[model samples]
Target chain A: MPLVDIQLIEGVFTEAQKKGMIEKVTDAMVEIEGEAMRGVTWVRVQEFRSGAWGIGGKGLTTEDVRALTS
Target chain B: MPLVDIQLIEGVFTEAQKKGMIEKVTDAMVEIEGEAMRGVTWVRVQEFRSGAWGIGGKGLTTEDVRALTS
Candidate 1:
């Protein structure tokens, strides 16, 4: 039961899509283990406006991180 | 602003507490950015039964990850 956190910029999903995404993510976790998901809580998805975020004291966008990660 | 997603076990928060936790997490993101928060979304929390989770093909707990991180 490893707590996994995923952060992303907003607007990538709709209400239903969000539900699906959450389920999918959970599914991935469950795939690794049978009953691994239990008593889990979702904090929130924070959407930062431009200039509201930075990397190493320099402004960076979620796209930037996605690019870096991808 | 990197999209950050936090997944945790349920019951650590109440409805009101969940709201606060969400806000606090958001605040942290915004602190790194002023207008960086906008258009976000929250999916859902998944709880798995025992024997449902594993690490490296063996059962593991969220506390284990927390311990590793801490």
Candidate 2:
């Protein structure tokens, strides 16, 4: 069973976006691991507070993510 | 760097429980992968909506989880 967890800054995505991510991730895992594992694939989307995510001694906020995505 | 994600039914665990799980899971990964990986290990505890978790043709809800843990 492949469990996929995606972490993102809170308030950035809609429910629809999260659902899409889950479906796509599950499809990718099934494509790699085989169809037998499809039913057991679990995908979760977690949101962290703004400024709670750090990378290379820098904390990232929704503004940082928005700048990149926008 | 290893990312460990734990999935559980919602409402069954307290914040402390989830934090404990994160710490223990991180420690487990570090124990197997080596000490250098400890700093980069990302552990997340995800809670699914009740009745959202499925296993072997059965859907598990918070009630079922509570029953088991109780």
Candidate 3:
């Protein structure tokens, strides 16, 4: 079974986007693991509090992530 | 950067258990990746709705998982 966990800063993504991510990520894994594994492929989205995600010794907030996106 | 994602059936674990998981998983990765990488190490726990996780072509509910534990 392939388990894919996606972490995002809280409030950064809409529920629709998260659902899309789950579908696309599962499809991507199935592409490599083969279609038969789709039933066993698990994709879950985990959200961290705004200041809990860190990179380069600094915690990142939703604003930080959104700034990078734009 | 090492990212560790743990998936569990929702409502089975307490907040403290999840916190402990994040700590232990992070330590487990640091043991392999080295202490310097701790800052970049990310351990996330994602909980799936009961009946969302599947194994052996069958969807597993929270009770199924709890049954296995007990």
Candidate 4:
């Protein structure tokens, strides 16, 4: 079973986007693991609260992530 | 940076339990990656909605998970 975990800042993505991410991640894993393993592939999105996810000793907020996209 | 993602069935764990899991997971990674990298270590817990998690092509519900513990 291939399990893919995607982490994002909370409020950054909508439910539909998360669903799409799960589908695409599963497909990506199946490409390597084979179609038979599709049913066992699990993709879950986990969100970190603002100021909880740290990088280089800096806590990132949702606005910080949004700024990166722009 | 070491990222540890833990997937659990929703509603099965309390907030304190999850926090403990995060701490333990981070410690486990630090043991391998060293103390200097601890700041970059990320341990996240993602929960699947009841009946959304599947194993062997069978969807698992929260009740199914609780039953396993009992």
Top TM-score hit? 4
- Which pairs of residues clash in candidate 3, taking residues 3 or more apart in a chain or in different chains? none
User: DockQ for each candidate?
Assistant: 0.15, 0.12, 0.11, 0.13
As a whole number from 0 to 100, the lDDT of residue B28 in candidate 1 is 43
The predicted structure with the larger lDDT, 1 or 3, is 3
* Winner by lDDT between candidate 3 and candidate 2: 3
Residue B40, candidate 4: alpha-carbon lDDT? 85
- Assess candidate 3 and give its TM-score to the true structure: 0.55
- CAPRI band for model 3: incorrect
Instruction: Give a tens-digit lDDT track for model 4, residues A1-70.
Output: 5778887889878899889999988888898889999998888887776645544334566888889877
Better model by DockQ, 1 or 3? Answer: 1
Quote model 4's TM-score: 0.56
Question: Number of backbone collisions per candidate, in order?
Answer: 32, 0, 0, 0
- From the highest TM-score down, the ranking of the candidates is 4, 2, 3, 1
Which stretches of candidate 4 lie above 4 Å from their native place? A1-7, A12-70
True contacts kept of each: 0.30, 0.02, 0.10, 0.12
Estimate the lDDT of model 4. 0.78
User: lDDT per residue, candidate 2, A1-70, as tens digits?
Assistant: 6667677887777666666776777777778888898788776666788889899978898889888888
Best by DockQ: 1
Cα miss at A47, model 4 (Å)?
Answer: 4.0
Query: What TM-scores result for chain A when each predicted structure is judged separately against the true chain A?
Result: 0.49, 0.87, 0.91, 0.91
lDDT of each residue in B2-69, candidate 1, tens digit only: 35454444432246544543454444444333333433323334445443466479754555543433
The alpha-carbon lDDT assigned to residue B32 of candidate 2 equals 92
Candidate 1 off by > 4 Å: A36-44, A56-70, B1-70
Candidate 1 vs candidate 4: which has greater TM-score? Answer: 4
Q: Interface RMSD for candidate number 1?
A: 11.0
Provide the lDDT at B22 for model 3.
Answer: 71
